[model samples]
Target: MVTKIRKSQRIHARIVVMDSDKEAVHQLMRLLGKEGYKVEAIEQINKMLEKIKNEQIDVLILAVEAWDNRGYELIPTIKKMNRFLPIIVTSADDSIETATRVREQGIFFYAIKPLDIKEIKLALKNALSKKFVSSGEALFIQKEEIQKAFDDEILDLADASKILKLSKPTVSKLVRNGELPASRIGNKWYLIRNQLLEWLRVTAAGNQRNYGTLILETMDEGVAVVDRRLKIVSCNSAYLQALDVPRDQIIGEYCYRVSHRSVVPCDESSCPVRQAFRTKRPVKFMHINYDSEGNEHYCDVIALPMKEKDGKVAHVVEIIRDNTETYNLNRHLNWIRSFFAHECRKTLGPIVMNISALVDENLSASISIERRDKMLLSSLCSLKFLHDMIRNYIISCKYETEKLQCNKKSVYVYKNIFPQIIEEFHPILSKKGMDIETEIKGERPIWCDPDFIKIAFSNLINNAVKYGTAKTKIVCWLKMTDDEFEFNILNEGVGIPHDKLYDIFNRFTRFGKLAISGTGLGLHVVKLIVEMHNGTLKAQSGYLIDNKPITYDEFYANENLYKMKDKNLRKFARFILKIPSGEDTQKMEV
Candidate 1:
């Protein structure tokens, strides 16, 4: 049964309802009025403070959803106006976050939406009774005694445990350990509420500091806190690990001494920490640092300033990330670019000079027909070499940047592509006294990008001719299976070393004669093209024994082949390429 307030007591009590929902406000007003309380309803939040200030309000029912939930923000303000006013909060939101926030604001009671009339009546009756008791106590106790009671408000074990959200045993342990401010009186422990609150505040702040420290310790990047004097105040484990120093040796040491191994500070213009302090803002830059053992590192440093209440920079937090590997890679790429440019100029210079000499009337008249023909041939060879170099370099770059795409079509290798490529290399082949012998067993047309296949064959054939011994035969073999096509090229020469066989396929890698002028990107480009078509390329180099080819691995395994003299054994280099044929090619294209 809902207990109603007595007629005499309800005559003086004033209850105000603040909500945007007119229907809920009307219901609350009618219910409370029937209970003999003088109830007033106000929709506007702005008028709430005015209503309270002008009249004596014993209870306030505030809807948190009113005025876009600004009612929660007004709790502290309302309390400041009348500290003793009983505020009952109502909300449609029943989430724990909302309930916790409302309860923390010192509301008398919290009710979910569609407020229960019986519950509100009971809460109002209890609030008024408590207010009357408080009024009576105020009159009985002297003001000085009330102040004294608040200062020394005694609490038993249950009260302390409840307030601290801890079990009784834990609270007892705390009291026994002297961690909590308490006193033993007549076999029971008593605590002061004021002292306990102070202890909680201090403990909460310490936990926050510990949380921040834990976060820093878990990071992969090195983090350090430095004071205004550039002395390291504290650092995480990563910072110590990066510097390869003990924590005791790092703390309180100068940041410059620990990071740069310098007696003085680093240059202010380049130091991100110094810049952050000067600007009172965050700064980031790259830095070169040395560890304890003097190993150099390229570091990316970010510094954020810690400011004081007066807006003055107090300290700077430095975050260091190692970027040495990336820096070295970029430097190496830059060097390769420079080398390519030099090679282009060197090749082009000769071609221009030769053409100019032939064009001059005086030079042409002095030159014999035989010499003129030789000069033309030399110019054409140089032009071809330059053309091949530029084409391979461009293709390599396209593949590297992921812009190269193959246009596939059926191609007869021996009939259309191989013959043309062989004819193109005739000049160089005849000059070197080398001959190419082909044994093609495949009659089926291979599904591939004809242009790319042509380039791949040209590169292989060129390498074979360039490195082969004079009067040696370069063997080319092609065979087709049910699902794949295989091509192999074998050349007799001063073969590539076993260790460098795989390395020769890398960009700008050359293992052959240094006197021969050729771009190293040809083999790399061929490897890229082959891989793009879902194919594989491999190289083997060793000596031929009994007309049968023996790889370096096999030769090393056989003691007899290993002991053979250079004059007795014929060295050879071979490359094998395997590519998917016909319908198998469509899967990779997709």
Candidate 2:
């Protein structure tokens, strides 16, 4: 007709190529650009969804090998995002199964690798010109025709239940409750096939929403939904609890204002919610939030997008898990490591210097024999201290990681275990001018792991010798009760404060004197060992008054004990270990 085409009728299409192979993508892009079409290339699968959602893409060339052969899996989601967008899948796999699966996903074409450029061009031209029947539109058309046919087709409750995949009783109840479109005819409810199917679809959709709500409510992790405006749409109990905010105040509130108390939103790079909305993809990151009282909390946040029908992000579902306690524990562990390193260096520094001097012939010759012997003894003590510390640390780690198991057996604690432990510590006892006075009232072979018992008592005695006043007595009482084995070690030394007594057995806890060379794991390890044997450990430290053990609290309450002289007050610390000896003792053995 020789008529000019309208501006709106001009053919201008955009094509996106998703491929892991760079050279292939470049060649395709150049070919498409030369054909006077706008082309974009994406190498990462994560970026593909965002590009499709943000841009008006007419055709997509998806390489099956891209994202490790997971490219085809994206076809369904892509179709959901844009029903009319044509996807031409390219695969190196020439298997019929792959081609069939790709076609079943409703892709425009399946092109095998070593692709023909001319064929791809022709497919592109056809895809651009072809009219697409969206699934939603097709479903609507099918439902209209089905409804007309169903006008004459009637079904009873039993028949409707089969089609709905529901129990007959459920269908009857729905009919009784007027939930399903049905009518009573001759005492039996009858439903149209189309109406029954329609009712089932609506009910299933509602059930899905209920299931989602139930899941969100039951989860321990905080979950919340936020719209694009940064306003919270809904939240679970945990979400409210995490922020310590009232439920009434949380709904409809700006997420930034509620969580951060800030006027502006959080930075998109750090905020998972914002990033999910911006990228139209799932995001995960660590977030630091502040409570109502301005306390910092560490949280692991995962934000997933809830997309609209048009492939735009409508809301983000944020899952928050509180990691504040775990974070603090890790920080404390790192601090313990640093402290341990410092202790090792402090203990080794003098030993290294002493050894260097001993190695120097001139230095050794000039030193007195008595002084050299003292140095040797001091070095030996230091080495023993370091060795014990390391051993305790290893045992403590084993206990924490649940790798330590007690091999329990019936053993004589007083005769076999105590003697060896005493003999081992004889040198340290003599050096510290300490004497262990044992009052043995238990002669029975207790049911326990002998090696573990030895280690337990050794740690207790070592602790007594370390802090007990020089030349003071360490009184040990071993008694056998009808139901349990009782052992107590009372030493006159630095008394623990009332507050510090509560956490005395906690890992890496040290109090009273910081200058003492101890790993702080000795008592903790002793506690673990005692517990492993179905026993209990208790510590009491204070002065004695009226032949009764006065606790730190009593000492502080009484003005007389508070003002008493240090020498007369008689500060003492007693640790009691009691192991059950009843019938359950047999079960303690692993």
Candidate 3:
């Protein structure tokens, strides 16, 4: 379908010349005619397009300075007419800027005008070789009197995908499911094309116990072979079974058509196949794919380039590995850590704020004894709540470091942990008039560590109470699944930002405001305890509350905690604590 004819293939090849100077064109045409090239002269840029469309042009030779823009507009116009056609730009001016721009556009070759015949022939050879054989001239083509060329390794499923231009899932399923004949080395799967085509010819004859059939019966992945231009030369049974895509739909299509699901020609810098061809280096990428039902899959893709006889590339091999489960587990773990950190920090800020206010106001001098006693009791409760928070954090850290242990003792988990946290937060919640609700979904007497779970629940509930807005209800509940238990605390308040969700679990990471007096350890301790118990914990900020959704980003963004304030002793203490967590954590002796 390509328009440009190869110079060797033509009886007397036509050369298209675009130059403003008549003397130069006349002289060039005379020299070219003597060298057996028919000259077709065109002066205007607009006429050059017509000449390419109308006449048979083997090569386009243009004067760089004469076209004003060096045929930048004409290059694409001519290329659009014939993509494979070779264009040679000759410059009387050898400026680096012009050369760099020409090279950047992927020109066939660049040289000074009043050109040497030897250099032009070599450039023409290179361009024609690429135009015929593609990128690296590595296409495994054998002509009469010429020997066939190939790489040492067997062709792989990756190679098949490239040749067939199909998705990896479709290909891998066939290869790994034993519907094709392919061998594996470590993680790489390969196929032999010569053996496969013979098998196909046999299979078409309806006698199936041949060597190729036996190999296809054993293969665990899909396999196909492609030329440098990514045309399907052959395929096997395994490839068909895995892809779930009919061979008639994919054979002879470009590689990216199936893999990338794109119809446009690839931009060199952005195309993975082109990158491999340009550098002759293998590349592996982990990519995510989503199905129509919204299920996600993680795929590991590896692509390697094959070279032709002229040291140009002719083919590419691609392999795909599915690792969906592993990706999900890691993503879940990260989200859990982030949620806890965010919720814990939000609760921590208010405690610090109340403490600062308490210290500043002299309650004894102005308030009566009854009110004073009430206020003092409230402050003491806040301190105890803070203490319990710190304890939860320390326990979480111990569990992470593998230092937490269970005694396997029977204990009343709710009666012990609930009362302590509730008593500690009673005065504070009472002052704010915040209603606290707790419910045990299904209590079971199973083997468990009471104190660790108590601390974890305490952190979650306390966070709910502290950040829960005035007149809002904070509900705490727990449920038991088949093999695991779930604890949830819902509070009507501002949620955490989506961007900050991942970083909340790291030690010493305070999300917003220094108003809360916390050790930044609650969630870390919860994570540790969950790990120790072989359980998991997760925190969510933007859940529906009483049939209404709250936007947290704008809420937290406008908070006073985000603003700079006058320095205090608390800030100094935080500054001092920052050093050990930064450099000392890595220096912790074995």
How many clashes does each candidate structure show, in the order listed?
0, 0, 40
TM-score of 1: 0.50
Give candidate 3's TM-score.
Answer: 0.33
Candidate 2 on 1-590: residue-level lDDT in tens?
12222222223556789888888888888876776667888775545665655445668999988766677876755654455567999988999988988898888888998888888977876775553233221111233533444343556688788998889998888777445666543356566665567656766776765566678889888888899888987788787777775564676689778766776887878888989988999999987877767888887888999988899998899887778889977976885688668987888988898888888999999999987877776777788788888888879878867899898777667788888888878767877888989999846667788888888888888888888889988999999755689989988888677787879999878874557878689999999999998899999999866646787877778887778646577678889999986564434432
Order candidates by TM-score, high to low: 2, 1, 3
Q: Which candidate is the best by TM-score?
A: 2
Candidate 1 lDDT, 1-590, residue by residue in tens: 33444665776777788887888898888878887888888775546665655435678999998766767876865664455568999999989999998899888999998788888888898777755543232212134534544544556789789999999999999887555766553357667677689778877876755676678788888899988889987788888777776665676689888877887788899888989999998999997888766788998889999888899987899998889878867975785687568876777787788789899999988999988877777777777787888788779877766799999887667788989988998777777788999998857677899999999999998888877898889999988655788889999987888788879899888865467777688889889989978999999999888867899899889887788855578889999998888774434322
Clashing pairs in 1: none
Whole-model alpha-carbon lDDT for candidate 2: 0.76
Q: For each candidate, what TM-score against the reference?
A: 0.50, 0.50, 0.33
At residue 402, candidate 3 shows an lDDT of 66
lDDT values, one for every candidate: 0.79, 0.76, 0.57
The superposed Cα distance between candidate 3 and the true structure at residue 215, in angstroms, equals 54
Q: Give me the displacement of residue 425 in model 3, in angstroms.
A: 2.2
What's the C-alpha lDDT at position 422 in model 1? 85
* Candidate 2: clashing pairs of residues: none
Q: Rank the models by lDDT, top first.
A: 1, 2, 3
Model 3 ranges off by over 4 Å:
1-367, 389-393, 480-484, 500-506, 513-515, 543-590
Q: Which candidate is the best by lDDT?
A: 1
